[model samples]
Every structure is written in C-alpha cells, then in structure tokens.
Target: MHNNEILCRLLAAATLALGAAGAHAQGAAGSWFGGIGVTHIAPDVSSGNLSPPSAPGTQIDVDSDTQPTIFIGRMITDNWSVEVPIGLGFKQKIQGAGAIAGVGQIATVRTLPITVFAQYRFFEPTQRIRPYVMLGLTYTYNHDEQGSATLNAVNPINPPGGTQIDVENRFSLTPGLGVTAMINERWFVDAQYAKSFLKTKTTLNTGQTIEAKIDPNVFRLAVGMRF
Candidate 1:
C-alpha cells in the first residue's frame, strides 16, 4: 500500500480510539490556540515540454520536502475557527525527465506557501475527539532558483552559457480534513491532510518556458495548546 494510504489508516484508527477515552477541553468560542509541528509536501507533478528549441520530449520532475511549521488560530464560535500556517520555506530539487532522463538535476528552487483557512469543527465542544473540514486559499512564492552543472552541460534549448530559471508565483484553492484529540485541558494532538489545486510556469533566462502541474499534497501533525 502507498505510504499516504497507510498514514491515513493509522490516523483514523487513532482518532476512533481517542473518541472513546481521551482527556478534557476543546477550542471553545472566543478561544485562541497555537502549535508547532512539521509538514511534508509531496508534489504530484505532471510535466510539460520545454517549449520550442529543445528535445522533442524535454520535461522536468520535482521532489518532495519536509519542514518545520507553526499554526495559530482563533475560535470564532464553538464550531467555527480561522487559522494561519507559517513555515520558513521548502527547498525542492528539479530534475530531468522524459526524453532527458539521464541528465540528472536541472535546478533547485525554494518555495514559500502562504495560506489561511476557515474551518468548521464537528461534534460537541466537550467531546474528547473532534473532526473538522476546512477550505483555504494559498499563494505560492518561488525564489532562489539555481541551475545545476548538469543542466549547463545539457542545455538542450540554448547554448551552455549557464541558464537560470524563474518560476512564476501562483494562487491555488485548498481543501482539507483533520481530527483533533485532546490530551488534557490545555493540550491536544491534531493531524490533517490537504491538497492544493496548483500549477505554474517556469521561464528560462534564455527565453524558454515550461508549464507544470504541481498539485501538492500537504500532511501535518501537531502538538498544541489552548488558552
């Protein structure tokens, strides 16, 4: 089975168990909460051609990344809340694919995904375990794109004079589901899974472009405190 599938099952089972025997409290109305955790981003990339002046099937691939993150939120009502997630950035490796399979790495880029979610909690505030659904908007900013030596040597579209890449910023719609299990009156554990409907274009300094679908799956687990 896929790793993601396995994780889903594990989290679901844990949530069910917690619902029967867990500690006190909840994110009651007008309350504030915050947490620190780690997140994993896996991009399901659908690559595109490098536009004219390149190999017939020149394409690219993106790898996954993990980073530390923080979350802060306010419960507007007993069943409604808003949250913001923050992270330093995610560094991803860009590699050769399709017709240029052996070319190795093409470039590296760092990205920051900014998002805000409006969520609705399920079950009563006094419940030990609660499930939630959320909808969010994200703005992705990409920077520090540096091409590799392999890319320079295999500059299929242009002469090997050191090519630099720029990936355009994008906005995407995000949707998610999660479960929160209170450990005590002041602490809780939260697990969530979300997906972004995302796509972007990469432009080369040599005047070439490639559009790719980077619909990334985001997974998170956090330990938090309520006040």
Candidate 2:
C-alpha cells in the first residue's frame, strides 16, 4: 500500500509540472518581440602576404570590439521565427608585423554587419526554456579606411605622405545557436553565439592587394519582452 501511494504521488507531481509548463507556453505566433543587448565580435584573422612580399614575413592583425546591439523578431509559428540583428559600427585596427614588427597600428577600418536569421526553436512554445538554431546571410560594409603616417613613409605611390587602402563589401554565411529562458509571461533572457565565413581583399593605392579571412565569431546577451 505504501509503494502504491508513493507511485501516485509521483504521478501527481508530474502532472502539476506539465501543467505549469503549459501555462508558460502561450506561443509567440503573430507576435512581435524586441530587445537590446551588448555584442562582442572576435575575428579569426588570417591575412595574406603584403604585396610583392615586400616584407616576406609580413602579416596583419585585427582586434576585437564590443558594441550595442538590437534584436527584432517575428514569430511565424510555434517553433519558428525570423530575427534581424542590428549592430552598431565596430572599429578595427590594422597593425604591421614580421619585417615591420614594431610599426604598431597602421590603419583603422569601421565596419557594420547587417544580417537576417531564420531560427527554429526546440520544445513547445509554452515551455519556460527553449533552445534554438539559426542560419543566415550577413552583409558586411567596410568604410572609413584610414592609413597612418607610418605606412605612408614606407610606400609613396601617390606622391603623398600616406597610403590609403580600400576594403570591398562582401557577403558571408552565418550559423548560430542560442537559448532563451523565460523570467515571466512577458519577459525573457537570451544568450547566443554565431560565426561568419568571410573573406575580403584590401587594395592599396600602391597597386598592391592583400587577401584577408576575417571569420568573425559573435556573442550576444539580451533581455526582451514578448507581445
């Protein structure tokens, strides 16, 4: 009799747990969500040899930056949603190495990544916690390319004091994974990680071109409300 009573109690607890989970799901379909957060972008940089191998051992280095980010999403179904990530501009510094090991910062480039993601969430929408995966395309726009006087001293192609580099815009594929946890019926917290496959070429006025693989890894944390 005791064993049967314990079994009944376990079943009752499970039923209550499931009921609570159902109460939270409310499904976000046809609803809009918005959030704000901070993002950190780390680039796995691999740069090509400087033009003509002027400095045979020369390579480039780029530093990571953190900026504010905004998230806007629309739920199409119980398990799917579309998201747009709006990121503030990231500043990158280019430095010289190898033969010019001590040249320090040679240039600065500002970039903005515009991307849209299609996400598939796991578990029922009413669950308090859900994990998701995403795939998307990112468009990187590079601008404000500036060269330091140190770089100009090395190459005088334009009869000027410094050399200017042009970075072309490119598109890349991005894949990501994340988790969302509900704090209440109207609010939630999110954490995500994503990576981009990107390769771009930088051309100097000196008629030299260098290829760089700026595969960036992105991390974000946010708090949002559902409507």
Candidate 3:
C-alpha cells in the first residue's frame, strides 16, 4: 500500500512539471509581433546658401514636420528580432531669403523625402518592457522646388528655365534606438529615434550649383500587435 501511494504522488508531480513546461513553451513560441505607426521627421538645412534678400547673413530655419510610418517584425529568439519600416512624409516651408554673391533675391526652396528601411533589433525579451537598438539601410526619394525668379537670376528666363527641379530618388544609411512596451498578450507600443546620413546636390539649368545636404533625423511612436 505504501509503494502504491508513492507511485501515485510521483505521477502527479510529473504531470504538474509537464504543464508548467508547456506554458513556458507557448509563451516563447508566440512572442513574434508586428505594428504600424506614425513618426515626426525634423530636417534642417544649414551651412548652405539660398537666395531671396530677407537680409544679409540671415539663416533659414526649417521646423519639425509629421510623417506616417509602417513596420512589421518577428522575434527570432528570446532577445533578438528584426523589423522592416516604410516611411512616407513631407517637409514644407524651408524658407531662406538672403542676398547671394551675384544672384539677387534668393528663392525659397522646399524639400520632401520619402524613405523605406530594414532594421535589426537587439534586446532581451520581457513580459512588459523591452529595450533595443537598431541598425539599418534606407532608400530615399527626394523632391526639391525653387522659384523662377531665383533660377532666372542665374540664367535668362526661358519657357523651361524657371521650372521646379525634382530629384526623385537617393539612398542612405539608417541607425536608431528605442524602447518597446508590451501592454498585453496581443498589444504593444514603441518609441524610437533614427538618423539618415545622406548627401544631395542640385544644379540649376543655368550651370549654377546648389548643394543640399539632407541629414534627416526622425522620432517615432507606434502601437503594434502580435499574431
């Protein structure tokens, strides 16, 4: 009778251990997730020249603008994951009116950049909060507009002389850092920041050179869900 009781107790203990192991396995296997969110990109153009005549030595200050972003990710291990993010956005009203060396009344220029990126996440997985750093690559589409008067200053005004110039595509490097919070089994949120190291130059139809250095830095907040 004592031997029988001992055997029954051992069997019960084994079943409890198996149940606990199963629960842990389920949690780990289902941790993969994806999300969509919006971001704000603040691009600044400094140390360059634009023409208009607001004043001498007057600098153009561009403000921060909002952009929309989408992302999908998968947890490869307990502490590492990878994500791909697509960003579409615009920056308007980058106004700089200053007298040029020879060109009169520098024109106001506007630039818009659209980017897509892929990144890797490194962090320890946790139930509530996780912190990670990301490194990635981005493809950017850049559009720039300048006034006819400004273009005419460099060359005689023709039917196509003053038209807006658009450089549609470019590439750059993306690096970022952020933290993620798991609100529940299915919902999560994240806050992140990234920078783009790309350089672009514009040449007017009149043989004058306008160099635009686009080093974009971005801050983002997003909510996500796991499948």
Question: Tens-digit lDDT track for model 2 on 52-105?
Answer: 636576667777888989999999998899999987689998888667777888
Whole-structure CA lDDT of model 1: 0.87
Q: Which residue runs does candidate 1 get wrong by more than 4 Å?
A: 1-3, 9-21, 157-161
Give me the runs in candidate 2 sitting further than 4 Å from their true place: 1-23, 154-158
lDDT of 3 by residue, 1-227 (tens): 33235334433433343332211111133356667777666664553553222233533334556767787776666655667776555654444334333444334344444344443444444445555677667666555556546544443333464634444366777787776665556666677777877666554444434456566677777777877
> Candidate 3: which pairs clash?
51-105, 51-106, 51-107, 52-105, 52-106
Prediction 3 global C-alpha lDDT? 0.54
Per-model TM-score versus the true fold:
0.93, 0.85, 0.65
Point to the candidate with the largest TM-score: 1
For candidate 2, which ten residues in a row score worst on lDDT? 1-10
Q: Write down the RMSD of all candidates, one decimal each.
A: 2.1, 10.5, 15.8
User: Cα lDDT of model 2 overall?
Assistant: 0.79
lDDT of each: 0.87, 0.79, 0.54
Winner by TM-score between candidate 3 and candidate 2: 2
